[model samples]
Target: MAGGGGALEIPERQKRGKIVRRKKKKRIGFRIDLTPLVDITFLLLTFFMFTTTMLKPQIMEMRIPPEMYAKVEVRASELLTLMLTPENKLYWYKGIADQNNPPQEISISKLRALAIEKNLEPTVKNRLITVLKISPEANYARVVEILDELNQAEIPITEAITKEVDEKGEPVKRQRKFTIAPLTEEDLKLLQGEGK
Candidate 1:
């Protein structure tokens, strides 16, 4: 008998029946750390920054005189005048720009050859001065091409003729002497009269 109640009866189970219970294991939550991944990413970025090489810009070198207004007298025979028209036409003449020695139309392709031939002449060598006058309406690219052609024209020099020597102690190559000036009204008339 139970002390708090009347006598308690226990129920009997059949010999073939039984009950079973199993304990469940506690599950742990999944977590991911980003410290190592961040470190690796920074390491790769720094490696690329330190190993990459920067490219240099290509440019042409030009030297300007100290005095811009200073007038330098040059002989008429040593002067070579070049004019560019709005029609992309190029004209050149030796000495002064006049009707007698009128501007002859020349293609830009032949400019280098003509410049070299004139500069190598016995009378004009080392003394020839090139004057380029470009019209405001002329193509800028044509102007640059003309300048590049002139720059590429070089005159060979002998050690005995000139004392100038390059950094390598070799005879220096003489570049074409050139100057830029504004195209005047007279020059335009010359081109128009020539039927160009």
Candidate 2:
């Protein structure tokens, strides 16, 4: 009790440590800058576009006329037939057996006029049209020529031809091939007995 009462001294002062505050740590962050990328991309695009070639193209539009819806008229008695030979001979045949006239050999000039006249008629029977049949043995050039002439003359030609060389020459069992050309000499001689 004496020791406790007599010596109540305390060693003072190296200054007891005050409450220490904790410091906050600094944070690092990363971000991508898109402004420069966008600008560079736009510049490259503009440069490519300016340096590229531009061409002006010309285009033509074509239209095909519709075909007529009417049917073609043909008759044994009324049909006109044309034939052509490799040598450029022309023959025209028309009408019935026995009464059917042999093909007539014709000239291109005269044939042209005839074709024009023939084509000028309406192709329809009651419609004022006439039909001309052609046989296949006819020459290609001559047939085209005749067709062209008919077209120019406004003639409506039909599909028929003078197939035989001469009715007398063959047994009449041969091809009566359809030709688009005009008549030849052998055809007339055979049918009309008019050719050499």
Candidate 3:
């Protein structure tokens, strides 16, 4: 006979008719601690949350007139037209674009200086209107670049346009005189040297 705590016994019969007792073994159970693993997981999550950079959407602001059909006549002498072609070529001309006198090709790098010079001209100071005509096939990035240059040119030009104050004694806000228009077929023909 086998006795006691946590032990199992089996009875066996011997060849001489005597009974024998055998003991059974106990099995151990295993357990794992998940606290450290959970802590590391949370730590990595927090690290990424604190270190990751979030991208913000870039935007350009434009103001449009209330009346779409209203025609405001602009003098040809005060007009500065910039035409962008699909080939990434830039052409600029003062006054109206005429086939007899084609637009002069200009590089993007020199555009800023030209804008400043034209805007500061004695005859057209504070009155020059810049018209940007973009071809549908032109790169959007190039248009952005041109707008950026025009914006950069605004600061100095605004400063030069009299330091007069408004009714509130704040410096008068002179909006840049620029507009965007779609390139016409005639303009494309002019750029392709067909008009010449």
Count the clashes in each prediction.
0, 28, 0
lDDT of 3 by residue, 1-196 (tens): 4443434333322322342244444668888999999999999999999998898788888887777667889899999999998887899989976766679888989999999999989798888999999999999999999998998888888997758676888876666688888889988877778335
lDDT of 1 by residue, 1-196 (tens): 2242443332222212233233454688888999999999999999999998798776777776677778998899998899998888999999875657888999999998888777767787677888888999999899989988887775332222255566899765555577888788989898877774
User: What is the Å distance of residue 20 in model 3 from its true position?
Assistant: 74
Cα misplacement distance, residue 49 of candidate 3 (Å): 6.6
Off by over 4 Å in 3: 1-46, 49-51, 66-69, 164-175, 194-196
**Candidate number that wins on lDDT, 1 or 3:** 3
lDDT tens digits by residue: candidate 2, 1-196: 3345445342121122221233544677889999999999999999999998888775433233254444445566545556555555655545442334545667767766665454334442222222343445556666667655545443222222223234577422212222332344544445444533
Q: TM-score for every candidate vs. truth?
A: 0.61, 0.35, 0.66
Selected candidate, larger TM-score, 1 vs 2: 1
Query: What CA RMSD would you report for each candidate?
Result: 17.1, 23.1, 13.8
Q: Where does the lowest 10-residue lDDT sum fall in candidate 3? A: 11-20
Model 2 poorest ten-residue lDDT run: 10-19
Candidate 2: regions farther than 4 A off = 1-73, 97-100, 116-139, 155-196
